[model samples]
Target: MIRFGQLVRVQDGGEYGYAVIGDNQGDYFTENFGAKPAWSPTSKGTVLNPNEVHHRKTVVEDQTITLFIDGQQILSNTMDGLAKGIGAFGFFKDRGMGSVLVDNVKVTKITPERPVDPDNEGVVPVEIKSSDMTVRLDEAFPRVLDYTLTNGKKMQGQPTKIDTIKINNVDIVPEVSLEKVSENSIKYILKAINTENKINADLTILLEVKNNTLEFSVTEIKNNNTSQKTNEEIIRTLEIPNHSLVSVNSSETNANVYGAKISTDTTVNGDTLTEVTDTLRSFNSNYMYAVISNSKLSASMHSNSQYSSGGGANDFVRINPRVKEFESYNSVGLSSSPWIYHRDVMFNEQTLELPEAKVVITEDANDDGVVNWQDGAIAFRDIMYSPVGAESVKDLVAYRIAMNFGSHAQNPFLMTLDGIKKINLHTDTISFTKRLW
Candidate 1:
């Protein structure tokens, strides 16, 4: 079985946040994408920040939920399960702001899976706290969900379904592009593959085509591993040729190395009462990409022992009030790298690890593979999602090494993980294989 995951990242002034890819049962909260704007935390209110995308970034800590925008603590409160296991990090739009981009989201776990090797590849979890967390949660890249936007509009489909834009009857890896069209839209070219075994075409894959979407096939061969066993090898990638299908990009580029991005498009009705997205690259793997717009994302680790909302004695408590609301729009909220990373263990022939049905590599195994609950516990993928903001995007994307992982639900086993490095996309489009990492 192969496990996949990423690191947690904390944004600075850009107003962003994200936890390592894992679970979010204890991690629950909501906020306007970027509405309600106040430079201070609110005990019972929220401010409004006018950004393209507005959503509520709620981090339900063991005892508090602090809202942040542009690295500014706007609102905060105490909650019931504030100090528990954090699972997700993404955006929540009640009805403010408009089309925003959430990007540069990743989740990596430092807390090594129990019984893991002492000398792991990537970083390991130092500790889990609820008050002034001693460990850096920001650098972890933890997430429960992912909403990837190329420029300012939809690049894939919904966060639940990956955009299987096949190029040549093969599954296209992301981060690969076709062309930088008109500087307004960068053609994110994709290629597809077909097979039951490595390079074998045993079935057909379905591709989700949205507005101005196209599907194609691959003409060359460049994949290495068809699957992995340990969590370390689960997220292993197979670089493509010049016509590679996985070379994706963020709306914003840090230095062709690390940063967030949002593809160009006119579908973003953020200026209206609608919020659309294509969380294409969100599931089935440990790696992911997110989009962050003129907004912010954040998270906080409090000490489970003695943590407060900074509101004094009774101020650190949570507020469940019913206030007159306006159009589905609040003010600036908080979140982090909008992403989800999960790990599963299978002695052999895992669910997604092997193959099933649908899009590219789905399947009908001895156990069956469905997304709803009750999918059985046979080493499948974990689900993590979150909201990526300008701040969170700045912390992760382009990191030299990053990864994540999890364990089996019924067995007494643990999975190990490793960090991937030198990952790059072939922006040239003509010869993806020639591109250097």
Candidate 2:
């Protein structure tokens, strides 16, 4: 198929062309006759069989082109800079492939409706409240306007900024929409456009309030531009600015003051110890949770550890938390690398649905009657190990032994007994008698 005013030529000589050929079983190509040929296998061999009447349908919508064979979609390709003029369709057969038949050709034009305008036009802010916390959302740029706990403690600073979304090293400020699912839950739909590369990104953010915790999830990220030939990387970041808390604690990092410390002297070993603050700290690793606290309350951010592994050095999915100064106030937040790894030279299109991360606000996370960094570390351990029951030290030792013995000898208890009896040992003198049991 070729757009109107596009020349149809043989063997990579046309301006625009799309074709499905059965020469090598079955495969399809976009821009078949151009300098860059985008070809993909259907994996269904013999798409066009001899002595058969087949129904083929092709639908073009903006940059997306979909081909359906007998009501089953065979391939869908999205390219950049496709001709928008009237389309022209044609059929062709190779000289040595014998005669071909074409019939019942039909063409239908479709006009898609524009997206509905948001209710508030982004002028007014939307609020979702629960018994323990209240969250305000800015519909203009789709960011948290205010996050306040029930005890009148605010989690954010003034003049909030929009979250960052980068594609191919370019920052994209997306159009935002807010949908209130319930009194305690809301969804944000963001559509970011990269005009330089002609790419569109559809992102979904879901926020829910459960008791004293706020659950935030980047549920879906779709790359609408399915250009297999282009190289792209996406990064989604959520930053909570102007957080006043100076103390930081997590399992992955040491306890330190992220911002300027107040002058509070403490007597340690009969010596006065003055509070100290350090420079900016950045922890880049697979973190399950991090807690920032003050004298009264602590806020803990939890992530799913299973998705945090990068599997190799070249590709990574990490939870990054940085502590820095924003508007002279201490700030801390979480950001993630590319969730989808397209390391192969020729990568396929992907849609990623990520796991949700939870934020808990409390005065004592471990119920230790104090609000401190230890409470935060205890909270992290609880969230990490609660899913699986507690393991004893002996059980852990046995597990380590089994791991060291390799897969063939996995039962540590049996292996230990056998070793004591010299069952598999080469020395016949070191045998244990039956009465030794």
**Clashes within 3 Å, all models in order:** 154, 0
User: What's model 2's overall lDDT?
Assistant: 0.50
Model 2 is weakest, by summed lDDT over 10 consecutive residues, at 1-10
Model 2 Cα lDDT, one tens digit per residue, 1-437: 11111122233234344545544546554444343344444434235666776777777765466767778776776644344335455655543544555677777777554333223333466777899888776666445555788888765412334445555446667777878899998898888787676658787888777776667777776767656454543333322222121223222223332211122245322211112123332222234344556566555555542333322321222344454433333344544323433334353445323545565656676676777655655554433424443443323322112243435545556666676456425554442322111
Each model's lDDT: 0.24, 0.50
Q: Go through the candidates in order and give the C-alpha RMSD of each one to the true structure.
A: 28.0, 20.3
Worst 10 residues of 1 by lDDT: 298-307
Pairs with backbone N, CA or C atoms under 3 Å apart (clashes), candidate 2: none
Clashes of 1: 154
lDDT of 1 by residue, 106-215 (tens): 33433322222122235322222122111111112111121222332211111111233332224543333233233222223333344342332222222221222222
All candidates' TM-scores? 0.17, 0.47
